[model samples]
Target: MRRTTTGPRDLPPLGVQQAFRLPETADVVLPEGLRVVCLRSPSAPMIELVLRIPFLCATENDGATAEVLATTLLRGALGRGEEDVDTELARAGCSLGAVRRSDRIEISGSGPSAALETLVGVLADVLTGASHAGTEVDRARRRLAERLPLLRARPSTLAAEALRVHCRGDSPALRLIPAEAAVASVTADGVRALHRAAVVPAGAQLVLVGDLDPERTVALLAARLREWRSRRPVGTVVPRAPEHWQRPVRLVDRPGSVQSLIRLVSPAPARTDPRFAALSLANVVFGGSFSSRLLSNVRERGGYAYWAGSRFDDILEAMVIAVNADTATDTTVSAVAEIRAELRSMATKPVTDDELRVAGNYLLGASALAMSSQVGLATAVSTTIGFGLPPQWLESFSDEVRSVTGRQVRELAEEMFASATFTGVVLGDARLLAGPLGEHLDMVLA
Candidate 1:
């Protein structure tokens, strides 16, 4: 097949088209109370497995223990050592990892469709018979200790950590990096206890997407995962994020830094709310994309920063809108002022028809792109399951984006962004930033 040699200008004009079709989905609840979500993508030759366990740590120490457990769970299981497990998975063309998040622990893996049974068996073994060896636990703990300091050295990471602490207020959920002392104190027994308490089948979701029969897959999963059970009762309800957004500006003093990292955070609407579409569109207009007002004003026109953008997190109880920028220390105040002004403008003025159309097209195009891959589809399904949304929501998303009007965008802006309560953080050299930042914000050293 000869490839087309058309230049960019010689190609046909770009236009929006309905390009995505929702995959066939089935939701099943096993007798052991494990929820299974299956999506069949016959065109893909690979199968993806995503398991979401509702794992919550009650304290910072517990959070440390959970992190250690997540790292060491796959090291050995069912009479196999770490290298043995790796060799088996490699032979089956599979890979596995587990990540501990604020609300849950996600274990994800993928392999050839023909090896689905093998993948499931391996997953079951790890879940039920993981050997939390003392040596492996100690190694994981040492690795974490070595990584924490390097992560803290980055200005952006420092800014995010400060903001999370400001907003969440010492909650274990916000403890992304446990203290070195806490990690050092973690033991193999503690890791085992955490695994037993948090890695249960109850309130867990197993999502499978690829070329397979949903019914057959469900039956196989039921049989394979039957032995994995927990006597401890797990709560299905997701906890609410803090509602308080009002706070004085926090300055994490990263001395000798030439650039300042600015982070602005506020609360927004949840994904299930009727206003979510409107907020999403409004965000695209504000700072969610390259053509957004924030980028246009701060980076493009003023030439104040290298990049500026905003993002929205759709959690269970609440949503979060965050704007991030890295600018020279001298221009930090100006960049911040421009961001605030654009936010205020979005809330007060009505968006133009062209802006609305473009933002809607961007959202739809991005969604279509995301669903074009097996991993992407699996992730989308997992997110929907986490939000407690129906399967049809993914199918109807494009229509919902198309239905958002300028008036709805403006209204959502007014409600969510007009009186936006901002908790801002700046990580930079104190000597360079203290004067300008202090003029506009109540600077506090962190």
Candidate 2:
């Protein structure tokens, strides 16, 4: 028999991982100020398109108009009825959608590579001449009004809206859920006016990825969107979660609720910041993953919550990290306390060497998996580009995570994850949880 020792065996050292590289992209700017980025990936014979326009709402009513505009944009355009648009897209085997957010309006499309020109032409027509018909506008308005109550009733939605209100005050851009009256007031004329003012090609980004010639694709877009122009500059800088305007912990009362939704928000470094990688890994160890300390303490050990986690929320040039937990009504305060304890521990102590290595490996692996698909890669590139970072950021992110030291993570955690740095909202039966939570947090009723 082979000799065996009682001493612990040392595992082999990890080998160096290959660097992640995205396909090379060709970029161009149209005379109308539209930026086009195209990459050739032959994984499939289909193309994905993402168009981003800086559409800002000046008030809640403007948000209503934007919502209606997005709904009706693909409904009809250029003398084409809704059915006509659909038929044309179906002929090209294409699918498209338009979404309006507080910061921007996004139009995404996918189709076979052979139909790229036709797909882009349809989108261009919609962009330049969307017919926000009265009937469609009314239908969309009714749908939104009907759905608003259901969405607002969700505890998670309640907590998120409360957090936004507390962090950003009453900024209309951050008002994701509009009031019923606002939705009822949306009209075709209002949507058309908002589209005219906001949906110009100036300062917009269009990313196309698939099995196509990048140069030819750029040329095609430049020619097709030549008329999709306006003198208006981009509007609405994405709203940042203000670090200075934070309020005391808010308790949104939900009578007779069985569970409490807790959300804590704190400022986080933007992706372009050098500290971003360190903070991301630290977050993974702290609460970003299933194996995070927050979950282990608050759920597995204390039995106060079913789930708890954290994530980075993006804004214009900044970011915020949110810690979330849902727990039994009676354990609400205990869960919150455990979350705070994890934060304190992360802030005060250096993560172990093993924790740092695991977090780094997880971060790198997750990034690769997220970008493995053509759609995922396109989205990653477009999002990074939209945030004013070079596409190379995605390529270098793995290396950055690999190089992050335990000390760096600890320092970043200290800088960002302190218990005192957070402002939050708790949605629970205030009659049952208010007294207990108030003692541990600076609590207020909402």
Question: What's the CA error at residue 267 for candidate 1, in Å?
Answer: 1.5
Choose the strongest candidate by lDDT.
2
List model 2 lDDT by residue over 43-152, tens digit each: 99999999999876677787878888999999999999999999989999999999987678999989999898889999999999999999999999998888898988
TM-score of 2: 0.93
In model 1, where do residues sit more than 4 Å from their true spots? Answer: 1-11, 233-244, 314-317, 442-445
User: What TM-score, to 2 decimals, does candidate 1 have?
Assistant: 0.92
- Compare the candidates by TM-score and give the number of the best one: 2
- Structural similarity to truth (TM-score) of each candidate: 0.92, 0.93
Report the Cα lDDT for candidate 1.
Answer: 0.82
Q: How close is each model in CA RMSD to the real structure?
A: 3.1, 3.7
Write one digit per residue (lDDT tens) for candidate 1, span 1-446.
Answer: 99876777565766856846677777898877789988899777899989998765566687788888889989999889999888889999998999888678889999999999989988999999999899999999988888888877767666766777666665666666787778888999989877877788887899999998888999999999988987674333334567566767788788888899988777876777777888888889888889998899999999988899999863335568888899998888898788878878876677888999888888888888887888988898888887888667887766777777888888888777753487768888888887777777656767
lDDT of each: 0.82, 0.85
Kindly report which residue pairs in candidate 1 clash with one another: none
